[model samples]
Target: MITDPQGTVLALFLIFCRIGGCVMAMPGFSSARIPMQIRLFMAAALSLAILPVLWDTVYPTVHTSSATYIGFIFSELLIGLMYGMLARLYTLGLQFAASIIGMMIGYSQPGAADIFEDAPESSLSGFITFAGMMILFMMDFHHIVFRALVDSYTAMPFGGVMQMRATLISFTDTLSSTTYIMLRLCSPFLIYGLMFNVAIGFINKLAPQMPVYFISAPYLLLGGLFLFYFSVAALVSQFGQSFASVFIGR
Candidate 1:
């Protein structure tokens, strides 16, 4: 049964290279909190699991010369990285929206440690980001990502030349879609902040002697928090719903 143990091992490694590359860049899995050893083992396990299903495609590729094998390794890694980055970029758009929402709503306090990443973020931003990611997990976004990864073998195959132009286009398209979605999510806050500020500006002009900035700060925060409490469910729900279209539709 194990006649070509060397070939099998090579094929497994090739599969590992692709899956490992994906895990390396994937959002939740690639977090700084996750240990490298865990990531490695996870990738290896996935590679072994997928090898049986993809054996026909992968096994033949491994029988090639060393130079060609090296090329395949790079190609596989690039392909997987591209796929992982697609999901990662979409989640990153949520973070961008969080920052925008915080700024628009006057929640500009000093930044605190991010719940998922090592970076610092405002409390409001952190809340939004955390909530969005939680919703994604609840909706089992990883299942979609893994399904895409499995389908990629057929789309990309084992040893095709890496297409740099196509990869760049994919990245740009993901960014474009992500930006539009994030803007849509945060647009309410943008409008609210604008209207509130404009009204304040008129009031300030009328009562120049009053310390309007200091007086309006509390009202701004209160109204913003109240609006957030009422609308957060819809905001995050839309975020979760749009993930499929943004990541898969591309």
Candidate 2:
């Protein structure tokens, strides 16, 4: 019984390499707020669950040699990272766009520690990022991620070639798609900021003696906040829809 214990362990280890890499890079799951121990456990548990389903595809292809095994592990890790990074890139765009919106609307008064990320983000930026991530979780986004992880073996096959060119293309496409979506999400704020600022400029030109910068800053901040209050539902809803399309379709 268990005549090939070493092979079984090695097979599981290889599976862990890929799943662990994906877990460590995926958004929300990878957030600093989540303990590393939890993430490692999640990856290990996921690998165990997926191993049997992929046993024939993976176990046969695995090698016992230490050097060959190491190579396979790295390659598998790379593929997982590519898949995980695709989603991370999409969410990161929202964070970036939030910052742009805050700055454009004169709301970047101060920065606060982000609940998920290590960087200091404007309060609104941090809020939007957290809300979007929460909405994603409620939508069961991780189920899709894990489903794709399982399917990746079929798409790329176990120990298949890494197709560096296609990976590069994927990376580029994620970046471009992220930029386009973020721009669309924040365009309203951009327009509001521009029109409001221009009107303020005209007022300043008419009454140069009055302290426009001081006078207008409060109004600018107030208007942006008011607009955000009314528009946040639409913004969050549209963002969630777009995220689902990109995450699932990509």
Best by TM-score: 1
Cα distance off (Å), candidate 1, residue 184? 0.7
The sequence of per-residue lDDT tens digits that candidate 2 reaches over residues 1-250 is 6667878888998899888888888999999989999999999999999888988887886665778778898999998898889889988998988988898778866778988978888889988888888888887878888888888888777777788998898788778888998898899889999998899899998988998889888888888889888887887777777866776566
Residue 161 C-alpha lDDT in model 1? 83
In the range 51-90, model 1's lDDT, one tens digit per residue, is 8999998998788899999998888888888888999999
Alpha-carbon TM-score of each model against the true structure: 0.97, 0.95
- At residue 31, give the lDDT of candidate 1: 87
Off by over 4 Å in 2: 1-3
* Regions more than 4 Å wrong, model 1: none
- Against the reference, the lDDT scores of all candidates come to 0.90, 0.85
